[model samples]
Target: MKRKIFAGLAIRELREARGLTQLDLARRIGVSPSYMSQIEANQRSLSGTVIIELARVLRVDVSAFSSDDGVRLAATLREVLGDPTFGGLDMTQQELKNAALHAPKMARALVDLHRIYRRVEERYRSLDDALRASDGTVGSHQSAFEEVRDYFHFIGNYVDPLDRAAESLADRIGARSEDSLSRLSHHLETIHGISVSRHSTADGGGFVSTLDRARRTLLLNDSLPQATLAFAVARHLATLTLSDEIDAVVQAASFRGSDASAVCAATLANYFAGSLLMPYQQFAEEARRMQHDIERLATQFGVSIEQVCHRLSTLQRPGNEGIPIYFLRVDRAGNITKRHSATRLQFARYGGACPIWNIHEAFETPDRFLVQVAEMPDGDQYLSVAHAITKGGGRFDAARLRYAIGFGCELAYANEFVYSDVIDTRKSSAAVKIGVSCRLCDRSDCRQRATPPFDRRVTVDPDQRNIVPYQLG
Candidate 1:
């Protein structure tokens, strides 16, 4: 079916573009001139054998000729039929197709334009980042994973399993209170015999480390209220239930021999801690009631903003599922350190995101929120909404970093989110043109690019017009 579409179109385009008579292309492809004319008119269709023969002779994609897009292309081509000034045009559909065929640039330009326009109007997410992430290189994958880990570090310097756990506890108690952290700390030191302390003298970030081999005490240097409780809860879980699990993760990840074992152990410990708190079934329910509102849950449950954000990142639990989320913590410079994904999103690990994305824009707006129904390169679309989150720990003297968390999905799941209704889904299908990155993007007209991709050159300009010097060539 597709083959017939492209082949018929191809034959017509090639014959018409060069002003070729039926005899012209027939001799070229070794088919009878009459046969060529019939194919052009779609009175007969090209077989695979003929399809390849035409491509070999015409230098075009065989699939390009037989694609479903060809029918659309034909309809689009029909728009040109209304062109009264297309002089002396007694051309059949086959003749127009011949032009599309021989003039390869025209065929690609029209089809590419249609695809891009559909993306704009339709609102799709770009898959170029995902493709780049999947590049088969060891350094690339590790670099990405390290970026993920580092992103986690920047968020709170420790994953507070207590966020998920404490949220569940608050729901069970039928109350949401701001004093939950103090309540939690008292519950731990008094009820569970867990120890909590603050070492304000350290590098002044957050992370809970129990050097059972050396220091008998759990060391939490974040020295903040929520960090203290989170530290106590994580220490309790690791020292009590998850020690064996942590060992397993160490052995299983082959991290035991590497110095990164401690990091892996702590990371897995954080995961287990979050699992203990959220426990899948209970937290997933409240998450729905809270509408996945991070700050409200943090306030009600007495967890920190970063803690709620981190727990949200873990709703990826098996069996009792939850809304997919992507979480990240970045410095003001757009350096992302800890990022977690339960969605299809593949963010840039080493640098800032597309400036057009809402995360960066959130910084400018500060407390204001925004949503975008976005489309990507693979013909897939998603809705993205972001907000800026800060961590100065209720202390004015404390140093803080501004970060943004964006959680969204492929468009099919838009109805599942609160922000989806906040934005108009009925807008006209016009694409917001964006590239993966200038150095990695293939967009030719992008004025925002600072560099060009490796294989493509800067489309050099002889005349001054656009301020941006780089263009895809």
Candidate 2:
């Protein structure tokens, strides 16, 4: 099925930004002014050819008109509305989707207000605990983190200026060469007059890397893997070399506080470091040749498997875009530590993931990749791959961190993935039914549901019971 593009607001904003009138854009894209007006008014859907031409004329990626934001927003709205407080409203899916598409700002404002309400409610409930612990107040760190996360999420997770700058720097520093690590160290020492040194675990104070600006020295943990060492160096270099680009992004974001701004800056710097290490064009081409085999990409780029998966999610480079993959990292407790999706498979923002998803199962088997074909309640199928990664704990006294890294694309593009060959994509029966989370899920017969659907009434029978204790009505 083809997706209908109703990107009138986005197109109008871009045209105005570029100082182009409707008639001017119409003439440029070989369409009549009246037709362009309809497109802007969202009275007509944009065809594939027209979308491409509009992208070319507007100097934006074709994905600018994608329905991803609308879909993600609608899903979030659905989850928000699933709360029992809104049960009396009885909103429909189409109405929520229209709100997402046509009144996005208002929809976002509602989501934000709901988030604030949730936070306040949580804090209120925990006030007694906080008083007993003498903590005084709940911190705003999570709020700042979410603000930064959503900034990247809404922008499609691609920072073009920083990415290009990193790519250029990579070429200059010979990022693809075997001696890249040495080259990076040399570049920092020579160009920035900063000396790099490795320290034992005890001397490094449990930190992976630390910069002493006054002494012009960088201290790296000796226990870290070579890949991590290189990444640390590259990240520092990005902060030094791409400060202007990073600042521009931070300034444009208008984050709520200095904390969010600082977090966004660090994240953008890390993004630049990843781009510097992988070099977008070269990495994308090699990824295609290797069938996106995470192990091979990790080996080729001298990076960790987790890094490879994360980088794969950021390959949304306009006309040269790679497969739209969703990547996430989960700890042993099933809390998602990292997440990004260029696909329609958005993860739950407020709770744990579906228990039936293979990512949670990845913890059972170490040092191996697990693949699954999953069908969401929305009927979208995906080919997912998950692998567990253990980091740190090189010494007996040090603690080890275990996380499962998962990444996948839709089944339509499953053939492009190496893991897809082992699964029968054609068999609908093979696809395990899953949902984002139990609270917002509408699946009535799932025995593995940890919680009842929020929007549904539960029926308890004294006569009999099924695998699940209560039936959803």
Candidate 3:
């Protein structure tokens, strides 16, 4: 077998990112300047020894050079093109890949343009209140938020360098126990010279967290769960310690607007926080041992169920990868408030989620986990579990937020999930048929379909008696 070489362009990117000239890097790797130039230009492949040496000199993970940036860009562009608004555009996957590989800058520009178009369409064309919320006067902020979500989705929700840093931070804080809040608090107070304060919504007026730089005090919402409170502290610590690393990733992303850039910056900080709370290797092992049970994982880590689910989706660190899961959160109205997928499954980007999805039923059965074996029109099956998570409203008059969280992986990995115990994995036909959304679904016989598929035709017969008012063809 021919030994696979890492991306020469990626090596060059890392070299330049480290401010090392060709001769400087060549000297560090014990190679000739000409050889280094040839390797960067893809004229000559770097040997295994040199790749290891390059990583040592660059002070970066080997995966930095291993990944094909073009492939990543192509995947993101393909998802961008998959937007329903661009439904009629005739483009092949190969063409999209070529465009991304050969003209990456143009590909990025196209993505930015498409995002702008989507915001415009949502604002001007739709009359719904949700549309107003997503594309109101604060359109740019919403677009930036959506862009950040897509960024995580395309990258498989894992950031190796930040994850490693968080792991190291956890070790430094001596947070070996499942209850890490006290250790984390000690580290923040002693090592970082920051004081932690507590307040409630009734007292703080709904502020979750506030950092006073001058006073070196961190005010946290007392009403928050212990896990959430610890998360706030961890996130603040990450912001203080990992600013440069997080900023570096955000800068490398080349976000088109400052809003997007800021959102990404905050997201990377959160990544660090999540990694710190659930150190990758240990968390991945526990997840596998527990058969990927989110609730059990929550108890083991002393975190919230939602936090456990979110962290599960981010376990895609190359050699230590865990189960790839897709997570979705929706409001009572079926609007997708949060979505990220490590699987091939893509959520709807334009409108509400499909009503047939079990996530909607979660609201009716609050605090109860509902499991389903759902299959898409493309024949891809998933074992999804959902439950309604209520927040706040502790008092009689206080406001509450109710949202359903759903997550799952493909049926091929069904045996690994605890929710799959009740599912008959032997019968593929038993999966509940679902779709991305009403506008994209094409099941003519679906009794729950709310609208005709965008690409299909529908016939209405006044005299016809059926479950629906019209027949889809």
Candidate 4:
């Protein structure tokens, strides 16, 4: 069955951004003005053929019509409405979908307002502690981070100008050569007059890399791996050479305050660094050849495994896109430290992830890749791969940070990933049932549930001795 796409709001906005009228766009896409108006007014669904034509006419990626954002927004709305504060409201799935697809700005505003309310409520609950410990700057700082995160999400995690600039810089500096690190160091010293130096761990003060602008020197920790040292150098080069491009993106973003702007600039520099280290076209081609093998790709690109996973997620280069994979990093405490998705799988925004996920189990088997065929409540199945990574601890006394890096594409793309070759994606019964989070899950019979469904009524019966004590209504 073909999914109906009612992306009226997006279409209208894109048309207006291009300064095209209904008639003009209709003529360009070989459709009548009335038909175009109907399509933009949510009265009609666009065919796949027309969608391609529209993409070409609008000069945007065909993925512009993908329902991934709407799915994510709907999941967010579900989580928000599942809050006990809104438990009395009888919001239907269709209603939430409508809001997500038709009025995303309003939906996002509601989510933002709820976030503010949550923060205020938390502060109120601990008034004395908050008053004594916080200078009222924490909320703004956290809000700034959230704003920057959403900014990246809105851009589909692809910074085109910065990416292009980094790719060009990579080619000019011979980033793919066997002496890539040396080439980068030479470029930095000769072109930018910045000498690179490596310092012993004892003298580094736990810093990975430190730049002294006055001395034009970059001091890196000698304890760091070769790939990490190269990455740090590439990141510094991005900050220097791609400053103008980064500034343009930040300026155009119109973030709320200077804090968010600064964070955005730093994040864009990181994106540029990743692009430079793994130039898009070459990396994508090699990734395909390597069957999206994380270890092999990391080795081929001279980068870390986590870096390879992250770069794979950002392969949203329009027509040249790789598999639409979602990437996340979770700590031992189940807190998602990093997340980005180009697929339909949306991570929880407020609470811990589903306990059944293999990401959590990865911690038990260190350094081994754990694969799971999991299905969401919406029946979307994924071939997820999780590997536990330990960083730091260069010395025995240094703190070792443990995190699990998980990335996956939809089961439909399972053939492209080497890890999925042993699994049977065709068996629906084999897929473990998982949800975004415990609070929003509707799986009433789940014995592993930590909490009852937020929006459902529970009936507790003493006489009943089921796996769960309470029956969900």
Candidate 5:
């Protein structure tokens, strides 16, 4: 309320940041330095002649300092009505601002409802995560896509025994992630005779989707270069090496839904393939030998960039763990296709990611590498590097541009990766502190903001001019 300007201190901070020393400011405002200090120190009061002087000096409107919002809410109405963006709409700005102030609770609820309408899956995932960490049991999902992402989150993106087996293969054959993928494919073919094949999307969408209930044929697509190779490899391993164990894990899970079963099955195969490529002993040996250079590992194994990225996502296998990695794949438009985590990243399951996030920036640079150190709202620092790789045919006749893979992990283990060699470690991880979207991110000082979270207050009145839109107490 203007009658009770909640942020006289905020005004002082603005003055200081503008490089005006208290004495200099007092001289310009024709006030004693002692009086200015008293205002800042909260010893003297702020009203009337002082408020007018402040409005004049600070270049703010006199009404902002003189009247409470309840009184000036009518005046704030003018600024909103005059806004050209609302010119075409039937509602006036004052009506909008008054609705926003007098009943901000309703305004926030309306905003939230609109956001959910645009992206329900993300909200559902948030709810699911809240329920997961709170209770031991799982909650029902309102969005199928969210359900899918939530299901994957629960597994920590690691497949147990198969991953171990893959690690063993890594020791015997090699620890190259690509090599592991190739060998896993070979192992699956040799052991199960369940060959990989491609299918039309019209017939049945993907490898993991189509299961032969009649024939024990585990139909899979090899067209998907990285995950697919490892996938079929893991599939063979599951049906062959860890058949009983997988059956046990699946049975014990008591999970329902065909899609959920398919996802779990894919996860199991990937775990095995990861193990074969990095076999615990061989991987640990090569990881040390290569010093965890991800590019070098991909080169050594003759695999696509994403394969190596996906393999990095599986470094967590309990007793013989590797550096934990979090991998996210987003299209040029920043739609996340896949997310694998061995770290504490509560990524949004649906909707566009924050524009400030490095993943989106990586798209513009295309083939070039981007590395950034980011801190979350909760104060956890993470090291992230991203680059794009071709996904479709390379023929000028039919080739499609590749999607970028944004993969990185917490800084605590950054020393183990190839990316550790160059990035300046001195700068505060300031630019990296990004929130999801406003619906989820709760940062108090963002100016490129679209809307505040449902809980944040509009720190300043529209009638009251502040450089940045809001002031937080």
Candidate 6:
């Protein structure tokens, strides 16, 4: 069974652009006016013969009907619209489609403008009393990093061309062997004329992998688990093999500077590595079969739990999309370390995550999976699972940073995940009330409220004190 491709909006746009009426184009294409109307309105998918006739009569390439440009533009527009500063400004899907079809340049311009606005706002957000007193310019990379994050986020965190190319490379090199790391190393050394080496100890405490381009040697930290070592090698191989594909995405981003472009490039290379480790189609099937058990998927793919969870979030490749999920990582302090969403649940941009969320508790119980059915202020519910992950500090004296990784989807998708089997998501009393963050939350009765919301009035009582003395009005 093949999925149908409907280009009603594209057909209508092309016909109107060519100064042809629906009936006129229908007659020219040898189709009924009613049928043409249905096609133009996207009420019907065009057949092969109809597409050919449409191309011949319209005197335009058939690609006009199957342009990914419209899809990309719509994605950018959606990201631009999702800015918190543009809260309450809603646009319908039809309007977004029209904008992509008819005013792509304008749509891009809006995205660019929003990017600039966010950068300026970020500078202000980072400005402190000391910086202001000293008249020093704020030096924050949040804007640039957030731009790169937004680029991946709006694209649904999947780079199809790179992903497919990686899959092909994996197939060519026979990467499906039980000994994945050995096979991958052999492929790199034989096919790409690159030698793989490992560092006795973690280099500089921060660098995971480095490539000496002149020597053509890939150096990996020996301390990394086999999965991470293989991933590092895969990332380097992707840079070598898929440079053009990765560069194309970077070019399309129109990043503000070389630093931002470099970040985008690194992100894409990592995406390729993840996709290579877990080929999209096979991984999606296995995930569904395993009920999205991260540990099982990790063991099957010979990857880490974090790697499995991250790859699961990228299963949004159009027709092959898996269960839509949101992936979030936070430090013990509740600062969001990494966040991506394929669902409606969005993380806070400027502050700590909500205190009531189980991700916070994950820090207390390291390596133990915590499950919760949490309800947001808007009444949206999710089945969240979180566990703490510790990285680095192979030696006892070295610094060990602890972070919690959380991934979940809406209640509608609860049944599709393994963790939700033991929990009752349908019970209203079982749901834990949560919010985006303390400052952005409006839950007045929450005992865990840390601070007053930005838009709400606070009544401070001098004499009264309950769970909190301040009333959010």
Winning model by lDDT: 2
Model 6 Cα shift for residue 403 (angstroms): 0.7
RMSD in angstroms, all models? 17.5, 2.2, 6.3, 2.1, 18.9, 6.0
Residue 317, candidate 6: how far off, in angstroms? Answer: 1.5
Location of the lowest summed lDDT over 10 successive residues in candidate 3: 129-138
Please report, as a residue range, the 10-residue window in candidate 5 with the lowest summed lDDT.
66-75
Count clashing residue pairs per candidate: 39, 0, 0, 0, 13, 0
lDDT of 3 by residue, 179-271 (tens): 777788889899889998887765425566899989999988877677887888888988898888888888887777899899998888888
**Residue-wise lDDT of candidate 2 within 1-473, one digit each (tens)?**
87787899899999999999999999999999999999988788889999999999999888789878988888778878776667635678889888988899999888888877776676668756456545533646677788898888888899999889889988887875445677899999999999999987664246888989999999888887888888899999988878888999999998868888999999998998889889999999999999999999989998889888989999988778999999999999999999999998988887789999999999999878999998999899999999999988667777788999889999999999999989899999999999999987889989999989887789999899888999988
Off by over 4 Å in 3: 1-109, 122-138, 176-178, 201-204, 393-396
Better of 2 and 5 by TM-score: 2
**Model 1, residue 357: displacement in angstroms?**
0.9
By lDDT, the candidates rank as: 2, 4, 6, 3, 5, 1
**Model 2 per-residue lDDT at 259:** 81
Query: Over the stretch 1-473, how does candidate 1's per-residue lDDT look in tens digits?
Result: 12344356556676577786778778888889788878876667677778777777666666446443343344334333323333324455566556554454586465445433433332324355445445533233343345336334323232334345434554553323455445545555564565555566435544444434334344454545664355355445554645665666456544212435666666666665554444455556766886666666666555566666677666643234466666766666777667665554545533565665667777777776667876554344677767787754534455675787666665666676666777766663733545334443456666666655434545667775576764555
TM-score of 2: 0.94
Global lDDT of each candidate: 0.55, 0.88, 0.80, 0.85, 0.58, 0.80
Q: Which of the two candidates, 4 or 6, achieves a greater lDDT against the reference? A: 4
lDDT of 5 by residue, 419-443 (tens): 7667754567433777655544568
lDDT of 4 by residue, 365-466 (tens): 986899999888878899999999988766667767899989999998999999988888888888999988878888987888888878888899887778
